[model samples]
Target chain A: MIGEARIVKLDNLTLLVIMVGTILAMSIFLPERFLTVTNFQSMSSQFPEYGLFAMAIMLTMITGGIDLSVVSVANLSGVAGALVLASHVKAQAMGISPGTIIFLAILAALVVSLICGWFNGLLITAVGVPAIIATLGTNGLFMGIAIILTEGHGIRGFPEEFLFIGSGTILGIPMPLIIFIGVALLVSLMLKKSAQGFKMYMLGSSPLVTRFSGISNNRVIVKTYLMSGLLAGIAAIIIISRVNSMRPGYGYAYLLLAVLLAILGGTNPEGGRGGVLGLCMAIVILQVLQSGLNILSFSPFLKKFIWGLILILFMVVNYYQTNGWPMRNLVRGGVKTGAS
Target chain B: MISKLFQRNETYLFFVIMAFSFFVTVMNPSFLTVENMFDLVKSSSGMAILAIAFFVGLLSRGIDISFPAIAIAGQYIAVNALIAMGVDSLPLAFLISCAVGTAMGATNAFFISSFRMQALIVTLGTSNIFHGALLVFVGTRAINTGKLPHCFKAFGHMNVLTLARPDGTLYGLSVFAVLLLFVIILTWFILNHTLLGKSIYAVGGNYESAKRAGFNIKRTLFFVYGYIGFLSGIMGVMHLSLIRYSNPNYIVDTELLRVIAAVVIGGARITGGSGTLTGTLLGVIMMVILEKNLVLIGLSSYWHQFFIGLVIVLGVSITYYQSKRQNRRNLLFTD
Candidate 1:
C-alpha cells in the first residue's frame, strides 16, 4: 500500500510540474489570451466531453483490454439522444415539455451506450475475440447505424434548458466542470476503495491467476466494458448539449488522444495499473496545452505534431521509469525487457 | 484431413463468397459479366495488396494502423519528388515510395523494439506525427487526373487479358489485379520459404518463447514493419496510378479499418500467429464484392459498413470457437 501511494504521488508530482510549468510558460508568452477567465471557462467546458471518454477507455485499459469503439459509442448515444429531442421538438402536439424531452434524451443515450458496451464485452469475453478487434468491429457497426439513422446529417438545436447542461454555470463554476468532477470522484472511489477495484486490478495483472482464483473473469470484464459504455454515454450527452449538435461522426479524433491521456496518467496498456487522480491531471494538462497552443496561434496540424511528439516522449520516459533501462536491469540482475 | 480442411476460415469464407456472388447474380444479371468481374478485382487490387501488409502486422501480434497514413505520405512524397525531377518512370516512382515507406516503417520499428513499448500506441503516435507533419509541411492540394504522370495513367488502363465483346467493346483482367497476384505469390514465397517468415510466426506466437529459441527480436520486428512499409509504399504508388490521381488525404480513416476487416475476416488473429493466404485472398474478394454489389442487390451502400462489421465479428467468433474446441480445457488448479 505504501509503495502504491508513493508511486501515485510521484506520478502526480510529475504531472503537476508539467501542468504548472506549461501554464507558467504559456502565461509568460501569451498572457492576455491564455490567462483569462473566459479562456479558462471555455477550456473547462470543452474537456468534459473527451475527459469522460478518457475515463471510459481507462477502465477498459486497466483490464488489459481496450475499447476502440468509444468514439462510435459516443456518437451513437448522442444520435440516440438527439433523435429523441429532435422528434419531440418537431411534434408540438405531443404536449411533452422541454424538461421531459431532455430527460428522455438522456435516457435514450444511456440505454444505447449500455447495450453497446455490453455487446463489446460479450464479443471479448464470450466470443474470445481480442479487445482491439472486437471494439473495432463494434465501432464500425455503431457508426454505421448512427449514419443510417441520421441519414448522414447532424441533428441540431436543443432546447434552452437542455443547452444549460452544456453551458450553464452553478455559482460561477461551469456545469460541465461540476459534472465532470462528480463523475471523476465517483470513478476514483470505485477504482481505489471498492472490492471490484481489486478484482479489476487483479484481472488486469494476471487473467490466468484471476481465473484460477475462482473469480469470474467474464463478469469483471463485462462490467468494466459496461462502465466504459456508461462513461461514453455521459460524454455524448455533454458534447451534444454543449455543441447542440449530434452527428454520426462525432469524437473520432478523441480516440487516440484519450488513450494517450490514459497512458500519460500512468495506466499500462498491459493492464492492472492506472489511477483516476493521475488521469484527471493528465486530462487537465492536455486541455491546457491545447488551449495554450491555440492562444499562441499554432496551426491545427502543428498542434497534432506536437501532441504526437509529446506522447512519444512521454511513453519513452515512462517506459524507462517503469521497466528500467537495460543497463539498470543488468545492475538489478533482472531479465530482458524488465517487464515481469 | 477432411475435417481440418472444412475447419478453415478460408473454407467458410469461400462458400460465403460463392453464395453471395450467386445472390448478387440472381438479383442483377450484370454481376455475372466478365467486365463486372474484372472491375471488381481492379477496384479491390489496392486493398488486397494492402491487406497482405496488414496480414504481416497482425501475424506479428501487432496491428499497424499507421500504414494508411504512411502509404498516403509515401505516395505524396514520391510523387512530388518525381514531378520535381521531371521524371515519369513507374519503377522510379515505386522505388522512391518504397524507400520512404521502409524508412517510415523502420522508425516505428526503432522506437518499438528499442523502447519495448506497446505496438499500438507507438504506431498511433507515429501515425499522427507522420500524417500531421506531412499535412503541415507538405502541400495539401491534390494532383488531379490530368496532371498525373503519363506512365501512371497508362498503367491504369493496362490489362493483362483482353476479350472482345459482341458490341465491339473491350473487357479484360486489369494490370492492377495482376500486381495483386504478384504480391500474393511473392508474400507466399517469403512466408513459406524464408527464415524471416518463420521468425515472424515465432515472435507473434509468444515473444518470450521466440526469444529463448534464439530469434533476433529486434531484427524480426524491424523486418516485419519495414516489409509492411515496403509493401505499403508500392500500394501507395499503385493506388495513385490506378486512380490516376494523388490525394494526400486519400485511403485513410475508414479505409484502414476495411483493410483490417479483410485481413481479420481471413482469420488473422489480433493476438497473432494465425491466418492464411487463401483466407486473406477470399476475405478481400468477399469484402469487395459486398461493397460493390450491395446497391445492385437492392440495399443502400451504407449497409456495407454494417455488414462488414457483422462479418468480422461472426468470422472471428466462429474461428475462435472452432480453435478453442480443439484445445483441452483450462486447468482448474495451479501451483
Candidate 2:
C-alpha cells in the first residue's frame, strides 16, 4: 500500500519494485500449483504476444496517438503470411521451394504491416485527422480488407520450420520470449536514446510546440505509427505460428486487451510518457494475474470485470498523484472546523 | 453559390447522399417508393435515436462507446424488474430504463467530471464494468416475445399512419419514426433554445473559457453524460419494443461504431461545438439505406462495413480540409 501511494510521486524504480513485489506476492499466495515450470512456460508463451502488442500500443501512445488498428494490421499481416505459407498455395505449382516460400511469407507480412502503418501515419499526420479517429477508421478499413480476402475462414498448415519459431524453445527459453525481449530492448533503447524518439515525446506533449521547435512533426508522428505497425506485424507472426492458423476475424480479442495492457504498463492515454521497463512489468503482472485466475478457475467475465475496475482504480490513482487529493482538502477543511 | 455549399460538410454529404440514392434507385426502381422510404425511416429509428444521443456527447467534446452497454443494461434491468412485479406497462418500463440509465451515466459523469479523466478511457473502462457487472449479476438468458408485456407488443405494432396496398394489405408507418422525430425536435430545441444546451456548446468549444465565463463545468458535464444515459434508457425501451425481446447482447461494438460514423458523416465535429439536426438525420438516412437496401443494388450485405469504414475516413478528411480552408481564410498573414 505504501509503495502504491509512493507511485503517485512518479518514480519509475518504485513502480518496478511494486510490479516485482506483486510477482513475488502472487507466487507466495498460490505456490503449489502456479509456481511450477509448466505454468511458467505457458505464461512465458502467452505474454509475448500481449507484451509485443502493449509495446506497439505504447509507442503510438507515446506520440499522443493510438493505433486501434494494430490488431487488424496483425491479423492482416498474419493472413498475408498464411496466404503464402498455406498448403493450398502449392509449392509445386509456384515452382518455389518451401523454404523460400516461408521466407517470402514473412517478408510479405512485414511489407503489408509497413504499408498499413504508413497509411495510418498519412491519415493522421498529413490528413490532420485526430489519432483516435484516424486509427478507428483504419481499424475497420484493414479488418474489412482482411475479411474480404480471407472471407472469415482460418488459413492453416504452416511448415514445421516456421512453427519452430512459435513453439520451439531456445536454451530453455521460448523463442517468442527471446524475440519479445530483443524487441523490448530495442524499443527501450530507441525511446531513451534516439532523436526520433525524442521528437515523438515532444510531439506527444504538444504537436504545435514540436513543430515550432523545428521538428518535422509529420515525419516523427508517421515514424511512430510506422514502428507501431512493425511491432504489430511481429506479434502477428508469433500468433499465426503458435496457433498454426490465420483468420481475419481472429484479432478482435486482442484489441481491447492490448489497449488495457498498454495503459497498465504506465503509458498515458493522452501520450508523451512511458517506458519499456514499466510496460514489460505490466505485461508480466497481467499475465501472472491471468494465470493465477485461470488456476483458481475464475470465469472470463469476472476477470474482465476485475480488469475494468483495476483500470479505473489506476486512473484515479494517477489522477490523485498528479493533481493532489481533492478528498484530502475536503477532509482537512472539516478537521479545521471541528478544531475551531 | 456552389463553392459556398461545397465548403460545408453537410452540403457535401447531402450531395453524396443524393448521388448514392440516385444510383441505388437506378439499379432498382422500387428504391423511389414512399413505402420503401417509410420502411427505411421506421427500421432506422432506433439507430437514429442513438445517433442523436451520440451527437450530444460529441457536441460536448466527449466520445462514448458505452451507450450501447447502458442501452442494453438499462432495458434489461427495467424489463426484469417489471416482470418481477408482474407488470407489463410500457411507460413504466421506459421510466425505469431512463432512471437506471441516468444512474449509470452519472457514474460515468462522476469519473470524468470529478477526476478530469479522458472521456474515451473513462467510457471504455465503464463500458466493460457495466457490461461485466450486468452479465455477472443477471443471467444472460434472453427474454423472448412471449414473456414480454402486451403494452410493449401493442406499442411495437402501433402505427402513426396507415395506407392500404394494392393487394389490400395495409402498410403503416411505425410509431418509432414519430418517436424519432420527437427526439430530434427535442434535441434541436435543447441545443438551440435552452441554456443547458448552449452551455454544452460553450464547454465543448473551449473548456477553460467556459469555466471563466462562469459556466459550472462539472454540472454541464454531468448533464451531458446524464442526458446520454437518459437517452440511452429511452433507446433501450424502444429497442425492447422493436425487437419485442430482451437479449443481453444487442447492438454492441460495430453497431456503435456505425452510429458514431453516421454522426461524423452528419457533420458533428469530434472536437465538438458544431453540428446540425438536419445533417444528423441525413447521415442516418444514408447509413440506413446502405445497410438495409444494398441488396437492391445487387451487392452483398458484407460490403456495408467496408462502406462504413470508407465513409468515416472520407468524412473525416473532408471535415479536416474544410476546417483548414476556413483557417486559411481567417489568417491575416500569408505565412
Candidate 3:
C-alpha cells in the first residue's frame, strides 16, 4: 500500500509543480502582461471553453473510451447556434434576447452533441466497434454534416448578447473565466467526492468485476457520453462567442488539444487512473507555452513542432517509468525471444 | 459451408468499394476516366502510405493518431534538407527523406518501449512537437519543391505510360499510381510472409499470450512505430512532390479524417489483431474516388469532406455489425 501510494501521489503532484512553475516563468518573463488582472481575466475566459472540451474528453477517457468527434460536435453546435441566430435577425439577425438565445443555443448544441455522442456510443457498445474507430467514424460524420450545412463558409454577425457571455466583464472579471472556474469546481467535486465518479472508476478499472457488482454498465457508458456531448456543446458556445463567428472548420484544431490536455493532466489512456486537476493544469501550461512561443515570434509551424517534441518526450518518460526501460527479450538456444 | 462464410468476412469491404465506385460512376458519366482514376490514385498515395503505416500499429493492438503530423513534419524536414543539400536527384532525395522519417519513427519507438507511456498520448504530443519543430526549422513559408530539381518535378508530373483511344482522348497511368501499387504489394507481402510481420498479429491478438509464447512485445512496438515512420517519410516525400510545396496549414482536420477513414475503410478492424494491406489499398482508393466523383458531380469540395465522413461511419457500422454476428455464430458453434 505504501508503494502504491508513492506512485499515485507522484502522478498527482507532478502537474501541480509544473503548473506553478509555468505561472512563475510567465510572471517573470512577461511580468506586466502575464501577471496582470486583465491577463488573468482573459486567460480564465478562454479556459472555460477549452476546459469544457477537456471535460468532455475526460468523461470519455474515464469510461475506457475516447471521443475524437468532440471537436466536430462543438463545430456543429457553434455553426448551428450562429445559423439559427443569424437567420432570425436577417442583419446578422438575432431576434431572441441575448440571455434567452445563449440558453437556447447551448441547449440546441447539447442536444445535437448528445445525439452524435449517442451514435458513437451505440457503435462502440452495440455494434462493438473499438472506441477509436467509432469516434473516428463519427468525427468525420459530424464534421461532414457541419460542412453540408455551412457549405465551407462561416456564420457571423451574432447578437451582441452572445458575445457578452463570452466577453463580458463583471467587476473587472471576465464572465467566461468565471463560468470556467465554476464548472471546474463543480466537476472536481463530482470526480473527487461523488459516488458516481467512484463507480466510474470501478467500471473503468475493472469493468468485469464492476458488472458483477451490479453496476448498470450500459447506462454508465451512455451517461458518460451524454455528459461529454453536453460539455462539447458548452465549448461550442464559448468558442464561437470568442471568435465572434462560426465556421464549419472551427474546432478542427481543438480535437488534438483536448486529448493532450486530458493526458498531460495525468489522466491515463488505459482509464480508471487520473484526475481533473492535472488536466486543468495541463491546459494552462499548454496555453502558456503557446503564448510564450507566440510572444517570441515563433511561427505557427514551429509551435506545432515544439508541441510534438514535448509530447514525444513526455510519453517516452511515462513509458519508461511505468514499464521499466531498455526492455530485453530472452533467447531460446540462439533464437531471440520477444520483449514484454 | 459456415467456415467458408467466416473466411469471406475479410473480403466484404471490397464489395462496398465496388458498389460505391459503381454508384459514383452512374452519377457522373466521366467519373471512370483513366486520367481521373490516375489522379485519384495519385492523390491518395500520401494517405495510402499512412494507412499502411497505421495498420502496423493497429495490428500490434496500439493506435497512433500522430502519424499525419509526423508525415507532415517528415515532408517539411526532408524538403528543407533537399533545399539545403542542393540535391537534384529524385531517388537520392527520396532516400534521404525516408531516412529522416525513419529517425522520427525511432524516436516514437524509444518512448513507447522505454517509457511505458501510452502510444496515443505520446503521438499526440509529438504531433504538436514535430509540427512546431518543422515551423521553426523552415520558418513560416512553404518550401516549393518544383523549383529545386528537374528530376523531382517528374516525380509529381511524369506519367509512366499512356493509353489513347481512336477518338483522341488522352488517358494515361502515372508513375505515382504505379508507385502506390508497388508499395501496397510490398506491404501485403511483408505483413503476410515475414516472421516479424506474423509477430505483430500474434502480439495484438493477445499480448500476454504472445509474451508467454516467447514474443518480444517491446521490439514489436518499436518495429511497428518505426515502420509507420518509414511510411510517413515516404509519404512526406511523395506529398511534397505532388503538391510542389509544403504548407504547415495543410495539416488540418480534413487530413486526419481522410487518412484514418482510408485505414478503417480498408477493412482493418479497429480492435487490432486483424487487418490487411490489400484492404487498406482499397480503402484509400474508395475514399479518393468518392471525393473526386462528388466534386465532378457538382458537390462542393467542402461538402465532400462531410459526406466522406458519413460514408466512413456507415461503412464501419455495417462492417462492425457483420463481424459481431459472425463472432456470435462462432460462439454458438463452440457452445
Candidate 4:
C-alpha cells in the first residue's frame, strides 16, 4: 500500500520540483521586478485563462480522447454573451433597466457552450466519428457561426458589473485566479473521490473492458465532453469580462498552449493517468517562463518556439521514462513490434 | 450489379459532385461557363497537391498537419532568398523551395520514427516551430509581385491551352492545373505500382505484420512525410506565383482544414491503409465547386466554412455506415 501511494505521487513530486526550479531560475536570471507583488498579480491574472483551457483539455485527455474545439467553443460562448450585452446596452440607452441583462447574458453563454459540447458528444457517440475528427469539424462549425454572428468584427462595451467577475479582486486576490483555483479543487475532488471519475479512467484504460463491465461508455464520453465544454464556457466568461470585448477569433493561440500545458503537467497523452495538481504546476511553470521572457524583452515568436520545443522535449522524456530507452534499437534498425 | 457499383465510396462521391454541380448551374447559369471552369481548376490545383499529400499520409496511418506550415515556410524562404539574391530563374527558386520543404519533412519523420511518438502531436509541435520560425526569420512582410521576375509572373498565368469565348474572354488551362494532373498521375503510379507504395499500405494496415514481413518501416515513413513536404513546397511556390505575393500571415489555418476535409471526404480513413487518388481528386473537385458556387449563389464567404464543416460530417457518417454494413457481412460470413 505504501509503495502504491509513493508511485501515485511520483508525477506530483516531479512537477513540484520543476515548478520550484523554474521559479528559482527565473528569480536569479531576471531583474528584481520579476518577483514584485504587482508582477505576481499580473501573472496570476493572465495565467488563469491558460489554466482554465488546460484544465478543459485535461479532462477530455484523461479519457483517452481530445477536444480541439474548446477554444472555438469558448470563443462562440463569449460571442454569444457579447451579443447579449451589446443588445442590452442598446436597450439601456433607450431607458430599459439593465439589471437582469448581465445575468441573462451569462446564462446564454453557458447554454450555448453546453449545446456546443453536446454537439461534440453527439458526433462522437451517436455518429461514431472519432473524437479528434469530430471536434475538428465542430471547431470549424463553431468558429464559422461565431464569425457570421459577429460579422467578422469584435463586440465590446460590456457593463462594469460584468467586467468585475474577471478583473475584480477579493481580499487581495484576483477573481479569475480564485475561480481557476476553485475549478481545480472541484475537478481534483471529482477525479479522486467520485465514482464517475473511476469510470472515466477505466474507459480510458480499455474501452472494451469498461463496456463489458456494463458502465455505459457512451454516457461517460458524453459527460466528459460536456464537462470540457462547461469549463470552456466558464473560461469564456472570464475572458470576455477581462477583455471587455469578444471576437470570433479570440484565443486562437491558446489552443496549442493549453495542450502543451496539460501534457507538460504529466498528463499522459495515451490516457488513464493525470491530476489537477500537475496541471496547476505546469501552468505556473509556463506562466513564469512567459513572464520571465517578457521581462527579458524576448520576441514573442521566440516564446512560441520555446513552448514548442518544451512540448516535444517533455513528450520525449515521458516516452523514455514510460517505455524505457529505444535508442539502441533505433540505431540498429531493429523492429520492436510490441514495444508500443 | 447496381449494388456492387453503389458499394464503392468513390461512386457516391462522384454522383454527389455531379449533383452539386448541376444544382449550382441551375442556380447560376454562369457557373457552368468554360471561364469559370478554368478558374475553378486553377484555384483548386494547390489544394489538390496538398490533398494528395494528406491522402498518402492517411494511407500510411500517419498524418502531417505541418505540411501547410512547411509550405508557408518554404514560400517565405524561397521568396526572401530570391528577393535578396535578385535571382530571376524560376526553376532555381522552385528547387530551393522544395529543398527547404523536404528538410522540414525530414525533421518530422526523424522525430516520429525515431522516438515512436504519435504522428499527430509530433507534427502539431513541429508546425508551431515552423510557424514561429517563419515569423522570426522571415518576418510578416508580404513580398509583392513587383519583386518577382517577369517570367515568374507570366508562368503563373501561362495557359497550356486557350479558347476564345463568345464574349472575348479567353478560357485557358493554367500551368498549375497541368502540374496538379502530373502530381495525381505520379501519386497514383507510386501508390499502385511501386514497391515502396505496397510497403506503406502494409505498414499502415498492420504494423507488427509489416515488421515481421521485413519492411523498412522507418524509411517508408520518412519517404511518406518527405514526399508530402516536397509536394507542399511545390504548392507553396505555385501559391505565391498565383497570388503574386508571399505573406507569413496567409490564411493557412483554414487551408489545412480544407485539405484534411477533402481527403477524409474522399473516403480516406484517419486510421490509415485505405484511400485512392481518384477519390481524392473527386473530393477536391467537390469542395472547390461547393465553395465557388456558395459565393455565386449570393451567400457570404463566411458561410463557405459552415457548409464545408457540414459536408465533412456528412461524408464521414456515410463512410461509417458503409463500414458498419461491411463489418456485419464479415461477421455473418465468419459465423
Candidate 5:
C-alpha cells in the first residue's frame, strides 16, 4: 500500500517539478525582473491563450486524435474578430456602446472557431480520414481562407476595452491568467469526474471496446473536437485582445508550441491518457520561460532557437519515457503481420 | 482486372498531367512555348527534388515538415561562406551547405527514432530551430551572393541546349530540368528495383512483421530520414542555383503542405507502403502547372493556396475512389 501510494505521489510530483523548474529557472535567469510583480503579471496573463489551446487539444489527444488546425483557427478567429470590430467602428462612432461591440466581437470569434473545429471533426468522422492528415489538410484550407480574407495584411483597431481584457488585471490578477486557472479547473473536473470524459478516454484507448460497451465513438470524437474548438475560440479572443492586431499568419508559430505543451504535459499523442491539470502547469512553465528569456535580453531569433531546442528535448524525453525508446522496435512490435 | 487497374495507375496520372498541360496552354497561350515550358520545368525542379525527399518519409509512414527550414539554413551557410568569408570555391560552399542540411536531418531522425517521439512533433520542433539558426546566421536580413564566383551563378542560371530548332529558336530543354528528371528517374529505379526499397515498403506497410521478418526497422527509418535530409541538401544547392540568391525570410509558407499533398496525390496513402515514384512526378507536374498558371493568369496569390487545397482534396479523393472502385469491379467481373 505504501509503495502504491508512493507511485501515485510520483505522478503528481512530475507536475510539481516542471512548475518548480520553470519558476526556478526564471528567477535565476532574471533574478530582479522575474520575481517582480510586473513580470509575473505578464507571465500569468499570457498563459491563458496557450493554456486554453492545450486544454482543448488535450481532450482530443486523450481520444487518439490530433488537431493541427487549432492554431490556424485561432489565427483566423483573431483576424475575424478584428475585421468585425473594425467594420463596427462606424457604429461605435455614432454612440453605440463599446461594451456591446466587444461582446458581439467575442461572439463572432466563438462562432467562427467552433465552425472551423466542427469542420475538422466532420471531415475526420465522415470521410474516415486520420486526424493528423485531416487536420493538416484543413490547416492549409483554413489558413488559405484566412490569408484570402486578410489579403496578406493584418486586421487592427480593436476597442481599448477589448485590449484591457488581454492586458488588464484585477486585484493583482491578470484576466487571462484568471481564465487559464478557471478553464483548467473546469476541464480537470470534466475529464476526471464527468461521464463524457471517461468515454473519451475509453474511446481513445480502444474504439472496439468502447463500441462493444455501447458507447458512440463517433459522438465522442466529434465532441472532443468541439471542445477543442470551443477552447480555441476562447484562446483566439485572448490572443486578439492581447496583441491588438490579427493576421492570417498569426497562429503558425503557436501551433507546434501548443502541441509540445500538450505532449510534454503528459497527454499521449497516440491517445488514451493525460489530464488538463498537468497541461495547464506545463503551459505556464513554458510561458514563464518565454518571458524570462525575453526579459534576459535574448533576441527574438535566439529565443525561438532556444525554445525549439527545449521543446525537442522535452519531446524526446517524454517520448522515451512513455514509448519505451527505440521507436522502430515499438513500431515493429505493435504492427506485426499486418502487411509485411 | 484488379491487376490491370493497378497497372493503369501510372497511366491515370499521365493523363492528368496532359490535361493540366492543355489547360495551361489554353489559358496562357504562350504557356507551352518551349522557352516558357523550359522555365516552368526548371522552376519546378527544385520542388520536385524536395518532393522526392518528402516521398521517402511519407513512404515510411513518417513526415519531415522541416525540409524548407533545412533548405533555408543550408542556403544561409553557403552564402555566409561565399560572401562573408569570401570563399571563392563554389563546390566547397555547396558541399558544406548540403552537409548542414544532412546534419539537421540526422538530428531529427536520431531523436524521433531513438527516443520514440512522433515524427511530426520532432520535425516541428527542429523546424523552429532551423528557422532561428537562419535568423542568427544572416543577422535578420537577406544575404546576397552577387559578388560570389561566376561559376556559382551559372550553377543556378546557366542553361545548356539539348535539342535545338532548325530556325535557331532555342527549342532545346533546360539542363536543370534534365537533372531533376534524372533524379526522379533514379528515385523510381531505386524504389522499384532495390532491396533497400523493398525493405522500406515492408517496414512501412507493417513495422512489426518487417522486424519479425528480420528487417532492421530502426535502420530503415534512419536511412529514409537520412535520404530525405540528403535530398534536401541537394535541393538547397539547386534552389540557390535556380534563384541565384537566398533570403533568410523565405517562408516555406505553404510549400511543406504542398509537398505532402503531392505525395498523397501521387497515390501514396498516408497509411504507408504502396507508393510509386511515377505518381509523385505526375503530382509534382500537376501542382506546378496549377501554381504556374494561377500566377500567369493573374489570380491572387492567396487563391493559389485555396486551389492547391482543393486540388489535394479532389486528387486524393479521385484516386482513392478510383482504386476502390477498381477493386470492387474486379471482384464483380470475376464472380
Candidate 6:
C-alpha cells in the first residue's frame, strides 16, 4: 500500500521531470538564441492566454463537469470590451479620458463574462442539461452572438494603456505572465484551502453521496462554472490585449488546447483529482514545446498533432495508474489478482 | 390521439418540424416551392449522413466527435489518390475513402476498446490528430475536380426526377438524397433487426450484466465506432461529390455541433442504450429545415448557430425531465 501511494505521489513529479527534460533537449538541439531572455519573454507572453483558459477548465473539471464554452465566452467578453473601447475612443476625440474608458471597458468585459458563466450554471443546474451538452449549446450561442455583434470583422485599435495589460512588462516580466501567476495563486489557494473546493471534490467523486451529505450539489456546480466563466473573462482580456483586437473567431483553436492542457496537467476527466501546481507545470511544458516548435520552424499543425498525442498518452498512463494494469488480468485469463 | 402521439418521441419532433416549416413557408412563400423543398433535402443529405454516424455512436454509449475530421481526412485521401491515378470512377473513389475511414475508425476503436477511456476525450484527441495530419500530409489547398471524367460529373449532378421552375431552372431529387434514404433504411434494419444490434443495446444498457451474458463489450464498442467511421467516409465522398472539390479545412468546427444536436433532438439519450433511426431521421430533417429557412426568415447564417444551440439545450432538457418523471413513476410503483 505504501509503495502504491508513493508511485501515485510521484506522478506529478514525473510529469515535471518530463517537462524539464523536454526544455533541456530543445535548448541543446536548437540555436543558442533559444535560451535567450527575449525568447523566454515571448513564450511566456504567448502562453498566459492559453494558461488562463486551462485554469478555467481545470476548475470545472475538478467538479466533474467541463466548460466547453470557455473560448466562446472569452470571445464574447472580449468583443464586449472591444466595442466599449471602440466607442469610447471615439468619445476620446471629444476629450473623454482614455484611462476611465479603458477601466470601463475592462469592467464591461468581466461583467459580461460573469453573466455568461451564471447562464451556463443555470442551464446545467436549473434546466437539468448535462454539462457537456449544455456548454456545447451555449458555445454556439455565444459565438453566434459575438458574430452578430461584430458582423464577422475583428475590432482593433485599442488605447495604449489597455494594450499595456497584454504587452507591457513590469520588473522585466510580461504583464500577462504576471496576471497568470496571480490567478494561479488565487486558484491554488481556493482549491487547497476553501470549504467550497472540498465540497467540489466530494461532489465530483460522488454526486449522490454529496447530495445525501446535505451539500447542495447544484449550488456548488453553479459556483464552479461561474468561476470558470470568470477565468475565461480574464483570459479574454489578456488575449484581446495581446493581439490588440477582438473577433468572434479569436482563440478558436485554444478551446481544444485548454482541454488538452487540463488533462495533461493530470486532472481527471471524470473529475475529483488534480491541482494548480500540476496544471502550472503542464502549461509551462506545452508553452516551451510550442516555442521550441516555433524556433524549429515546425508547421503549426504538427504542434496540434503533438498535443493530441500527449493527451491520449497521458490518458492511457492515468488509466493504468488508477485501474492497476488491465493487461495483467488479461494475461491471467480474467482472474482477479490481489495486486490488481 | 394527441397524447398518444406525444408519447412517441418521433411524433413530437415531426409536429415540431411541420410547425416550423409552415412558419417559414408563411414568411416566404418561395420556400414552399417544390424546387426549394428538394434543394433543402439535397443540401441536407451530407448532414443527415453525418448524423447517422453520430446516432450509431450515441446508441452504443460512445460519442465520436471525430467523424467530421475523419470524413474530411478520408475524402482528402480518396480525392488525392484518384487524382494521382488519373481515375474518375466515383465508385472507386468511394471505396478508397471508406477504406481510409475504416483505418481511422479502427484507430479510435483500438484505443477506446483497449483502454476504456472516455469516448469524448479519445475522439477529441483523435480529431486533432486527424485534422493535423490532413494539413501536414495533404496540404490545405482546395483541389478542384473539374478535370474529372464527364461521366463522374454527370453522376454527381444526376437527378432522378425533375421539376421545371417558372424561371427556366430545373431542380430535382438528387442521387445523394436517395443514398441518404437507403442508408436510413439500412441503419434502421441494423438497429431493430440484427443480433449484433441487440448486443449493442445490451452492452450500453448495462456493461456488467452484458459481460455476464457473454457479450464482448470491447468488440461491440469497436464495431460501433468502426461502423460510424465507415459511414463518415461515405458521407465524406458524398460531400466531395456534391461540392465538386476537396478542401482539408472543410467541415472542421460547427459541423460537429450540428450532428450532435440532430442526434440529441432525435430523442437519443446521451446516457446511451435507447434511440431509434426513425427518430434520428426526423431530427435531422427538422434541423436541416430550420437551418435552410432561417435565412428566408431574414435571419443571417450566424443566427442559425444560435438556434441550433437553443434547440439542443431545449431538447435535452425535455428528455431529462421526461426521464426523471419516468424514474419517479417506477419508484412509486415499486414502493
Which digits, one per residue and each the tens of the lDDT, describe model 2 over residues B107-183? 99999998888787788888888888888887678999999878888988899899998999999899998888888
TM-score against truth, every candidate: 0.95, 0.94, 0.89, 0.94, 0.89, 0.94
Writing each residue's lDDT as its tens digit, candidate 5 over A256-300 gives: 778878876878777777887667677777887788777767888
Ordered from best to worst DockQ, the candidate numbers read: 1, 6, 3, 4, 2, 5
The RMSD (Cα, Å) of candidate 5 is 5.6
Fraction of native Cα contacts kept in each candidate?
A: 0.59, 0.44, 0.88, 0.47, 0.52, 0.61
Instruction: Give, for candidate 1 chain B, the lowest lDDT window spanning 10 residues.
Output: B326-335
- Candidate 6 iRMS, in Å? 3.5
lDDT, candidate 6, A1-340, per-residue tens: 4664465367789788988898898888875968899998999899889888899898888888889999999999999999988876687988989999898898999999999999999887776767877888889888888888998889988888889999999999999999999999999999879999989878777888888788988899999989999999999999888898887888888988999889888888787877898898899888888888888789888887887888899889888887777787686754556356
Off by over 4 Å in 5: A1-11, A92-97, A323-340, B1-3, B6-13, B82-90, B137-141, B162-172, B295-298, B316-335
- Candidate 6 chain B, run of 10 with poorest lDDT: B326-335
Worst 10 residues of 5 chain B by lDDT: B326-335
Docking class of 4: acceptable
Instruction: Mark the regions of model 2 whose C-alpha exceeds 4 Å error after superposition.
Output: A1-11, A87-89, A92-95, A327-340, B1-6, B328-335
Q: What digit string (tens of lDDT, one per residue) describes model 1 on residues B1-335?
A: 98998867788789989998998888889889988888888888888988999898888888888899889998999888888888988898889999989999999999888888777888888988988898899877899887787888888888999999999988888888778888988899888899989998998998999999999999999998998899989889888877778988664577887887888788888665888877888888888887887677677866766767776777778776655554436632211
Worst window of 10 by summed lDDT in candidate 2 chain A = A1-10
Q: With candidate 5 superimposed using the best TM-score fit, by how many Å does residue A106's alpha carbon deviate from the native?
A: 1.8
Q: Pick the candidate with the highest TM-score.
A: 1
lDDT per residue for candidate 4 within B1-335, as digits (tens), equals 99998878899889988888888889888888888888888888999999999888888888788998999888888878877787777887789889999999999999888888777788888888988878887787887777766656887889999999889977798988789989988998989999999998988888889989999999999999999999999999899888888878784578988988788889887654887788888889888887777777688977866777777777777765566557667863110
Interface root-mean-square deviation for each candidate?
2.9, 3.1, 3.8, 3.6, 5.4, 3.5
Off by over 4 Å in 3: A1-7, A88-99, A287-297, A316-340, B1-7, B20-29, B33-39, B167-171, B295-298, B326-335
Q: Model 5 scores what on Cα lDDT?
A: 0.77
Candidate 1 DockQ vs. native: 0.57
TM-scores for chain B, in order? 0.94, 0.94, 0.88, 0.94, 0.87, 0.93
